[model samples]
Target chain A: MAGQPPKVDVPILKDLTIDNITENVHRINSQGSDPRLKYILERLVTHLHDFARETRLSTDEWMAGIEFLTAVGKKCTDVRQEFILLSDTLGLSLLVDSIDHPKPPSSTEGTVLGPYHTHDAHDLDLGSAISGDPSGTPLLCLCTVKATSGAPIADAKVDIWETDSKGSYDVQYSDYSGEPDGRAVIKSDKEGVFWFKAIVPVPYSIPFDGPVGKMLKVLGRHSWRPSHMHFMFEKGGFDRLITTLFLRGDPYETSDAVFGVKDSLVIELGTVSAEQAKKYGVEEGTKLLTHDFVLVTDEETRKLRDEEALKAMRKLGREGMTIINGQLVPDVD
Target chain B: MAGQPPKVDVPILKDLTIDNITENVHRINSQGSDPRLKYILERLVTHLHDFARETRLSTDEWMAGIEFLTAVGKKCTDVRQEFILLSDTLGLSLLVDSIDHPKPPSSTEGTVLGPYHTHDAHDLDLGSAISGDPSGTPLLCLCTVKATSGAPIADAKVDIWETDSKGSYDVQYSDYSGEPDGRAVIKSDKEGVFWFKAIVPVPYSIPFDGPVGKMLKVLGRHSWRPSHMHFMFEKGGFDRLITTLFLRGDPYETSDAVFGVKDSLVIELGTVSAEQAKKYGVEEGTKLLTHDFVLVTDEETRKLRDEEALKAMRKLGREGMTIINGQLVPDVD
Candidate 1:
C-alpha cells in the first residue's frame, strides 16, 4: 500500500468547491477503472451536485436530506416499502420495467408490480371467479394465450387479481376477507383460453400512510395510482411476465402515478347480454373485458424454465434432507 | 406520442430473459445522446443488477430492498440522511470525494464530508477554539498554509473542529451554547501560520437512530466512524475542499464506517509541556499535537478572498423585511 503515489496525483484542495462537482465527476469518469460504474456514478453525481447547487443547499438542508432518506427505510415493514414507492412514483420502476420487458408485437404489455403481490395467492379452478360479493356489476375476465403468430398456446398459468367494486384489493381490505378478495391463480384450459368472473376494477389511490404520501404533499402531486388488474403469465417454455391490464378510458390511465400505462395493455370492458351473463353463471346483464396474451419464447426463456424447475425441485425437497433426532436438516447426507 | 413505436422497441410481452445488461450498457455508452449521463446511468444499472444477482435476491428480498430505500427517504428530515450513511458505509462517499478531490504531489489530500457539518460556522479570532470541554488531552493545533513549493498562503480561511477527549462533539452533547460547537473559523496569519488550542478527537459512532443502524445490524458490522477533525479550507478564487485530518493509529481508522481516511491526511498529535502550552496561551501541563497544512493557490483560490461578498449576496432583501400592516411584508422606505 506504500508504493510511491502516482506522479499524476496532484493536490486539488484549493479549487474543490460545489461548482467543481461536475468537473470532478468528469475527472473521475476519465480516471476510474470501471467504465460502466464510472458512467452511472458520474451521472448520479452530476444530478446530485446539480441538485445541491440549485438548492444552494445549506448544511442543515443537507442533513435533513439525509434524515429524509433515513425515514424512508424505517417506514418499511413486512408488507410494504416506501422506498420502492418512491422509485415507483419517480417513474424509475416503470422505465426499468419497460426497458427490461421488451415484448413481441401484439403481445400483452407489462406494467408496475403493485404493492399487494403476496406470496400466498390461493390456486383456484379454471372457471372459478374470485369475487364473492353478489353486488356490483359482474364482468367476465377472458384471455387466450398465443404465440407471436395467431397459434394458440394452451395451459399457461394465469394468476389474476384486482380491486373489489369498492376499489379495494384484498391486501388493502384485509379485514373484509373470509377468503382473500381479489386473488386467484388459474391455468388456461386445453383450448388456450382462460375465463373467470369478477367485478370491474375501479380506480384506486396509492398508499398515503408513508413518506411517499409526504413527498406527494410536498410536491403538490396527487397520491392516486391508476386502476388496473395484476397478472402473472407463465408457461413451461415462456418467460414469466408480471404485468397489469388497465381499463381503457379510465381517467387515471393516462396519468398513472407510476407512469405504468401502455396502449397494448389497455382493454375495453364491453357490455354483454343478461342471457349471456346467465349462461356464464353471471346475472344476465353484465359487462365483460375480453383480452388475450401472446408470449414469445426464446432460448433465455428456456433457461428461465430450467431455473424454475430447479426452484421447484428445491422447494419440494426432491433433494433429500438429513433427519437428525426427528428434525430435518438442510445439509445432511 | 404513439407514431408507431421505435423500431428497436420490442413488445412488452416478448421474451424478456435477455442476458445483456452489460452489452446494453456498452451500447448506451457509445450511442446515447448525453454520453456522460448514459455512461453514469448505464454503469449504475449494471452494478445494481449485479448486486441483485449477487444476493440471489427474492421478491420479498427485493421488496425489502425497496423498503430499505424508502425508509432512507422517510428518515430524511431536516438533519439526517440514512441513504448517505448507506452510501458512506458502502464506500461511495469516499469514492466520490476522492474522485472530486484528487490529491496533487504537494498539496494536502481531501476526504469525505462527515455527518455533522451543516451550519455556517461562526468565525473566531486567532487561537480561540469554539468548544471548551476539558475531558480530553489538550493540544496545540497549528498549521502553516504554504503553496505546493512552500510559498505562504496568508489570510486563508481555515475552518476546523474535532471531538473532545471524552469522545463527544459539541453538536452531540447537551447544553450547548447557541454558538457552533467544537468548531473554529479562523484566517491564517500573514505568515500563513494558523494555530489554536483543542483536545484530540476520540473515535465515535454514527448517530444510531435510523435505518443505517438496521442495515449495519443485518450486515453484522459496527457503526463506529474513526476519530478525525473536520476541515474546510478556502482562499479567494480557489475551490473549497471539505476534508478531515484523521488520527493515525486509531483502531477504527482502517474500518472507519464512513471510510474517510488517507495517509497524507494523517497528522501526528504529539506531547508538549505546560509552559509551552501557556506560551501558546494554552493551559499548562496539557498535551499537544503540532501539524502544518500545505495549500496550493491559483486563480481559483485568489477569488475566495471575497467570502464576505459571497455571504452578503445570500442575505438578500431580508434586511428590509418587516411585519408591515400586520402582515409579514417588507418595510418600505
Candidate 2:
C-alpha cells in the first residue's frame, strides 16, 4: 500500500477538538476476528485517551513515564517481576484476580499473589514441621480441604509459604537469592487434613529497590503488606483455589499495601499453654491455628476459568488473525 | 521499614471493591511538591485503574501489554524513536501541538512534527534546488512570512522538508544516511520572501520495520502519511510555527493516515508551459507554486501559548511533592 494512491480525507481543519481522539480510535476498524480483544483494546484506548485529556499530559510527562517503564523492564529478571509488584501496588492484579475467580459463600477466597510464591513447593507428611530452620515462635497449624458439597477433597495439593518471625521470607533475606523458604507443598491425608508446626506470620514490606518503590515514594504511600500465609489448593476435577490466610485482628490487615487480605480468609490464632504444647510434642507456649478450605471446580467454575484463559489468548493474539475491514488478511507492511 | 512494625490499619477488609480503586486515587494527597504533577498522576492512576476494571484485564493480558511496551523501548535508539511514532500515529502529538499552538484567524496552522524531523536541517540559499541529486520533477517555489497583523516578518528562519517524487524521505532510504534531500533551511529576505527549486512531494509511508508497523497491521490501519512539506518558521522574540502543507486535490489529501492535513495548510500547485519553464531557467513543462505563512506571536498569542505550556508542566507534576494524609513526605519503601 506504500506506493498505491492514498484515499484522501478532505481537510476540514475547523474545530477538531481533543475529544475526537477518543472517538477516532473506535472508528479505525481496529476490531479484529476476536470480539473480545476488540472490546478490551477499545476500553483501553478510551481510558488512556481520557487520562491524557483530563490531565492535559505534556510531552515531557509522557516521556518520563516511558523512561520509568523502561527501567521497570530492565529490572525484571528470573527472580523478580517488578511489573507484577507494580500491578500489585496499584491494586490492579488483585482486582483482575477477583473478577476472574468468584466463588460460592463457603469456598476459600483468593487474594493477591504477593511476589514470593515459587514453583518448587514439595510435599511433606501431615504433622511435619514446614520449616526446619527453628528460628521463630512455633505455630501448630492444621487445615482441611473439601468440595463445595462438604465432601472431603482427598489428595488435594496445597502449597504454603509465609514470612518468618522477623517479617522477611527466606528468599527475601541475603543468603537465599530468592530461593523458596518457609514454604512447603503438602497433600491432604485420607481424612482431608493437613497439619504442620511452623512460625507465626508477620507483616512485611515488599521489595523497594526498583521502580515500584520510586513510584510509591512519589505517591506518598507505604509498601507494607499485612501478615499472612499463602495457600494454593488444586485437585483433579476441581477449580484451583489460590488464596492467603490472615490472622484475625492483625493491625495492618486493613492496609495490606497490596490489599490481599479478605474477611473470609481470616482465621483465629489460638494460644496453647506449655503443658498442652508438650502434649503436642512442640515448644512450650506455642500458638495453635486451624482452618478448612472449600473448593468449587465443577462445570460452572470450569466454564468461567475457561473464559479467562480465552481472554488471555485473545490478548496474546493467539486466537485469530487480525481482520481488516471485515476481511481476513495477513500483516501488510 | 522491612523489620519495623507496620502502621496498624485496623483490620477491615470489607468495602475494598473495584470502585474503591478509582476513589482511592483521588483520595491520595495528590498535592505533590509540584501540584500539577500530583493532579496529572492522580488522573492517570484513576483512568488506568478504571480501564483495568472495565476490561477485567487478566494477568496474561497485562503481561502481554508489558512485553509490547518493552519491545517498543528496545526498538528505540538515537536513530529511531518508536515512542514518538507511537504518539504520532495515535494522533496525540498533533492534538497536543494543536492545543499549544492555536493561532488567530490569519495565522498559518501547525500540524505534526513527524518522527522524520531531525535537528540536522541545514542552511541553504534562495534559488538553490534542495536536492542536488536531480532525481525528481522540478518545482520553482516562492513563500513569504508575515506577522498576524500584516507586517512582514523580516529575517524569519524557515526550515522546509518534503518527500522526493517517489514519496520517501532520505532517512528512509539506506543510501542517504539521513542526509537532507528535499529539505532545507533558509532566511527570509527583507520582504519576507523565500524561493527555491526542488522536487514535489508525493505521499509516503513511515518507516515500517518496527513494532509500530506491527501495531498498524493489527489495527488494520494503513501506514501512509499524506503528501506534504514540513515548515518551521521562527523570528526573533516570536512564537515558532511548526507545520506541514499538503497539495490541494491530491487523493490522500482527504484520508491522510496521520490526519495531518489541514484546510488552512492546503494550497494549489500550478502547471507551467515549456516556454514559461524555460523562462524560469528550469526544465520544460515544470510546475510552480507559492504560499505565504503568517505567524502569531503578539501579546495575545503569547499568553495563550504560555497557558498551554503551563498546563503541560502541571501534568508533569509541577505543583508540589506528593502529600500523604495531608502532609508532605518522602517516598517510603
Candidate 3:
C-alpha cells in the first residue's frame, strides 16, 4: 500500500474478453512517454494477440514456446548469438535489413550482419593476407569503392571476415587464442582500390548444436550458408553497407540458410593464369575474386528510404492509421 | 558436402521480396512432418512478418527486440520464469486458459496460475493451519467442492498458496530452507468440505527486478496483483481447475497487473464473533472467508470446449482454411 501505483490515467482494466483484450492492452501502453515505443508496442500486441486468437493456441503450445525461447536465450554466449540466428532463420533479419537500407539500382545492396563479426580484427595494409595459416585454395581479392556518380571514393574502411578451409571461423575453435585470423580491417588507397590476399571461403554450417538449429531442423530446413566473405564499408557522408559476397558455384548459393544472398552480390571465382598469379605475388594458379562497390551518399539514402516508407504506408492504408514524422500514429483528425 | 542436405523437396528460396517473403517462408516450412507444428509455425511466421512489415520495423528496432527477448530469457532460473511473467502481463496467459478450459456457466471460471505456486506444499490435515509465523491477521477459510450436476466431489485435492502479510511468498525469501509456509496441499473431507487457518493474503508486487518489471515500468503500469489466495483443485472424473480467490475490497482487485481477476472469483471476508473464533480454536476477532466451487465433469468440459472451438473457427472463417480433426489446415479444394 505504501508504494506508488500505476500513474496511467486509464480506467482499471477488468473482465477482459478475447475480443477486447488487444484494445485494453493498447490503452494501458498508450501511457508511455515515447510515442514511437507506444506505437511499436501497440502493433506488437495486436499481431501477437491476433496470432493467438486465429490459432486458438492451447496452453501446452504456449508453454512450449516459452520453453523454446528460454533455451535459445540460454544458448547465447559472448561468441554465439542464438537470437540473431532465430531472426535470420525466420527471414526477419533480411527483411529488416532490406527495409532499413534501401539503395539506388546502381548502389550496392546490404544484408544481414551475422553474429560472428568481432572488433578485434587485425588492421592490415593493402594486399596483405587475412588468413593466418591458410590451408584452403589461394585467393586474390581485388575490390574498388566508388560513388554512384562515378567518383572514386578513397580512404573507405573495409572490414572483411570469412571461414577457413575447414568451413570454420577462427573463433569457432576450442584453442582460439583470441587472435584474429581469416579476417582483417583495411582502408582503400587514393585510387579507390584495395586488394587483399586470402584463401577462398568455404561453405559452412551455422552452429547447429543450439536451439536455433533445433528449430531449423523442426522446420525441415538446412543450416548451411553459401561460401561467402563478409564485408562492411564505412565512410563519412555515405550510408554504411554491410554485405557478403557469395561464390557463384557454391552448392548453397541459392539456399543460404540466412537468406542473405542477392543476385548482384554473387560472383564467380575466375582462375588466374600462372603468370598473372605470380605477378600478384600469389601461388601459380590462384582464384581471383573481383568486385566494385558503389555507395550512395547519406542524403540520397535518406530520400530513397522516405520514398519507400511512403509507398509502404500507402500499401498499408489501414483505417485510423497515419504517418507523422515517418512514425505511425493514430489519425486524430 | 558429406552431410545430407534438407530432405524436404522444396525449391531453394531466392530473391525474397517483401511481397513474397512470407510465401517463401511458408513454402519452406511446409515440409515439416507434423501437421500441427507446421500449422502453428505458419501462423507464427505470418503474424511475425506482418508485425515487422506493418511497422516498417527498422534494423535497430529489430536488434532491440532481440536484445529484450534475450534479457527476458536470461532472467529465468529454476524458481523464476520471466517468460511466463511476460506472457501474463501481456494477457496471453488468461486467453489461453480461457480457451483450453472452457466450462459450463455454473462451473467456476479459471484464471492464471501465477508463478508462485510450488509442488512442495506441505500436505496438511483438513482443518490445519497453513501459516508458519504469527505475524499477520489470522483468518479462517471454509470451502466446498461440488460438480455442476449437484453432486459433492469428496476427496478432491486442494492446493492453496498465498503471500504473507509482508507481501512475500515463502520462496521469495533468500533464506528459504525448502520449508513450506503459507501454502498447503489438503484433501476435502467426505462431505466435500475443507477448511484451514491462514494469515490474510496481502496485495503483492510480482518480481519486478527483471526484464518484465522493466517492461511494465516502461508501459506506465504497476506490477501488483490483488490480495488473493491461489487455489488448484483436482478430482477424478472432473476437469482440473486452476484459479485464485480475490478479496472483494482490495484496491487492485479490478486492476490486477496480470489480468487474472474475474467477477465470479471475488469474495468478501466477514468478521467472526468472539465465540465463533474460540470455537475454531483461533484468537478472537478473526476473519472468516468461505466459498463453494462448482466443477464440470471432464466429458461436459470437452463438449463445451468443442463448441467454443467451433464458434471460434466460424468467427475466423478465413478463405482456403478448413478445420480437420479440430486442427486448422489449408483446404486443397
Candidate 4:
C-alpha cells in the first residue's frame, strides 16, 4: 500500500531456482545507481546462496539463524554493540583490520576497537592519575610516541581507558554517574614522554548477558579477553592508532575470546621501585608498564593503503575480475 | 567478569590471518556438544570468510553491513517480522521452501509462506462469505483437495485469506478492528469440495515503511506483489499445504517482489453468471476461481524428504564431506 509499481523497465522474475536465483538477484539489483552498492550486494548474495546450498541448509536451521540475529539486534543499545561483538568473535574484525590498516614493519599493529570507548574521557596533564576508585594495584604507565624514523612526536594526544579490579568499565555500572573513571586523555611532552597512574586492568569477560554470550556457549568457547589497556593516539600528519597492550601473564592472553591479541602487542609488567615511584608521585611497589608506540605518517599510510588495494585488484584480476569506475566487477568479456 | 576461562581444553587462538581464521573458528567450535551446530557453523564461517577475502571487503563496507543488519533487527515487533521480509526478498525463503517441500510431479508445487498468516480465523460453514467489508467486487472460490492418486480427501481443513479492495490486509491498518475480514477457515464436505465468497484481492505492496523497504529502493526494485489469495490445507494423513494462487494477468505476477510466484501457482479467474452467483447467495456479476489442490500423503512426503536428504549427502560426499552421526563433517584422510 505504501509503494507503487516500478515506473522504469524491470524484469519479470518467476520460478527462481537455486542455480539461477543468484543471477536473477544480481540482475534485479543491477538497476541501482550506486555501482559500489551493486557490487557488494552481488557478492553478498552469491556467498549467502552458496553457503546455503553447500550446507543443504534446512528451514529449521534458517529460522534459528534468523532468531539468533534478531536477538542480537534487540540486545544493542547506546553503550553496547552486540553486532560488533559478533564480528569480533567470528574473527571478521581482525580480517578487516589486517586488510584496511596494513602498516610498515616499524609501525605498531592495530586491533579491534571494542564497544566500550566513549568520547567523554577526562583530559588530564601528563603523569596524572586517571582512576577515581582507590582500589587495585596502582600502575605507572610510561609511554613514548615516536615516528618510524625514531624521532620524538611531541604533543601527541593519547587516549587511554581500561576496566577496574572488578573487570568492569566505569560505564558498565547500573548507578553510573555522569563522570569518567579509569580513563583519560594525556598529551606527550616535548621529549615524547607521557605517563599516567591508574589501576592495573583485570581479565574480564565481554558482556556475557546478551545474545553473543549465548552464542559463545553454543560454540563451547569462553568469553574472557586478556587483561589489557586500550590506547588511541592522534597527532597531526600521522595515522591515528587504535590498539591495546595485553599483559603477558594473563590466562586468556593467547586465547582471547575476541581474537584481538597479537604477539607484538603482548608485554610483561615490571616492578616500580620506591625511588622511581617518587618521581611519578606514586607509592612503592607499583606496577610499571613502559612502551614506545611507532606511528606512520599520514602520507606514508595513504601510500601503503593504496598499494594494498592495487595488490588486491591484481589478485582479483588473475581470477577474472576487474575494477570498473571504482567498483569491483566481473570481467565479462 | 561473569564467566571464567573455559574449563575444558580449548585451543589457543592467536595471530589469526584471513586464510587461517576459518579453520581456527571451526576448531574452536568443534568442542560443542551438538555436532549439527558445529557442522553448520563451520560451513557458515567458511563462506563468510571466503566472501570477505574474495571481495577484499573494506572496514567501511563491513560496518555498513553490520549497521544494515542491526536496523533490520530493530524493526521487528510483536506483529511484524522484518527479518522474514528480508529473507523473503533475498529469495532465501523460496529456496528453503523449494528444497524442503519438493513435491511429486502429480502433486501441486508449494511456494513461500509470506509472513502474513495468523492462527486466529473464523471457521464458517460451506459457501459462507469471509469478507466483513462490502465494497469490492464479490468473488466465489471453488476448491477441491485430492490425493496424488486422484482420490478426494474428505473434510480437509482449508484456510483462506486475502486483501480487500484497497490492497491492504486488515492487520496492516493502525486502527484495525478485532473482526476478521476477507479471511476465513472452511472445511471440505465428503466430496472434498469447499466454496467461499470474498472480495477479489488486488495488487499490493509489501510493508514499505521499514528497513526492507529502504533496501528495495536501494536495489531499484519495486515492492509490489501480484494480486493473490493464500490457501492452506490440512488433513489427518496428508502433509500440510501452504500456497498461494496468483492472478495470471496481474502486472507483478512475473516479478513478485518477494520472489514467491511459481509457474504452477499462476491461475486465471472466470466470470460467474447471475444464476451461478445466486447459488452462493451473492449478487450478480460475481467473479469465479476454481482450482484443485493436490496433496501428498504424509508417508509419501516422508519418503521424498528422505530421498532428498540422501541425495544431498551423496553430493557432499563426492565433495569430500560426509554425514557422521547425523552431522555433516569434512572427510579428512
Highest lDDT among the candidates is held by which one? 3
lDDT, residue B276, model 4: 79
Across all candidates, the chain A TM-score values are 0.74, 0.81, 0.94, 0.92
What is candidate 2's TM-score against the reference? 0.75
lDDT of 4 at A207: 88
Candidate 4 lDDT tens digits, A52-144: 776767677888888999999898877778999999888888877776667798989988888888899988999898887777878899899
RMSD of each: 13.2, 8.0, 2.2, 2.6
* Candidate 2 lDDT score relative to the true structure: 0.70
Candidate 1 per-residue lDDT, tens place, B1-333, comes to: 111112232212222222433343234233324333333344344545443322223344455556556666666654454577766665446655543344456677777776666565778887876667756666677677777767788898988877666665666655655566688888999998888777778877786667777755444356675678888888875556677887878766555556566667776676667667656776665556666676645442333323322333245322433332212222346
For model 4, what is the error of residue A38's alpha carbon versus the real structure, in angstroms, after optimal superposition?
Answer: 1.1
**CA-lDDT, candidates in order:** 0.60, 0.70, 0.84, 0.82
Model 2, B1-333: lDDT tens digits are 522333543233453555565455445324246556566666667767767655556556776876676666667665567777777777667676666566777788888788777668779887778865566777788788988788888888888888778877777676666566778888999988888888777777776667777777666566777667898887877778888888887666655656676778888888766876765677666777788889887466657655654554456565633334322222444
For each candidate, give the interface RMSD after superposing the true interface residues on Cα: 13.6, 6.3, 2.1, 2.0
| True contacts recovered per prediction | 0.12, 0.28, 0.58, 0.64
- Best DockQ among the predictions, by candidate number: 4
Q: Which scores better on lDDT, 1 or 2?
A: 2
- Give the true-structure RMSD of model 2: 8.0
Candidate 3 chain B, which ten residues in sequence have the lowest lDDT sum?
B1-10
Q: Poorest 10 consecutive residues of model 1 chain B by lDDT?
A: B1-10
Best candidate, TM-score: 3
**In candidate 3, residue A297 scores what lDDT?**
94
User: How should the candidates be ordered by DockQ, best one leading?
Assistant: 4, 3, 2, 1
Query: Per-residue lDDT for A1-333 in model 2, tens only?
Result: 532332443233242455465566555535345565666667777776666655555455666876786677666655567777877777777776776675666777787776777786667777777765666778888678888888998898888988787777776666674445688888898888888877888877788878888877776666777678888888988867789888877767666667676777778898777876766787666788788889887565646555554454466465443334322222344
Scoring each candidate complex against the real one, what DockQ results?
0.13, 0.23, 0.61, 0.63
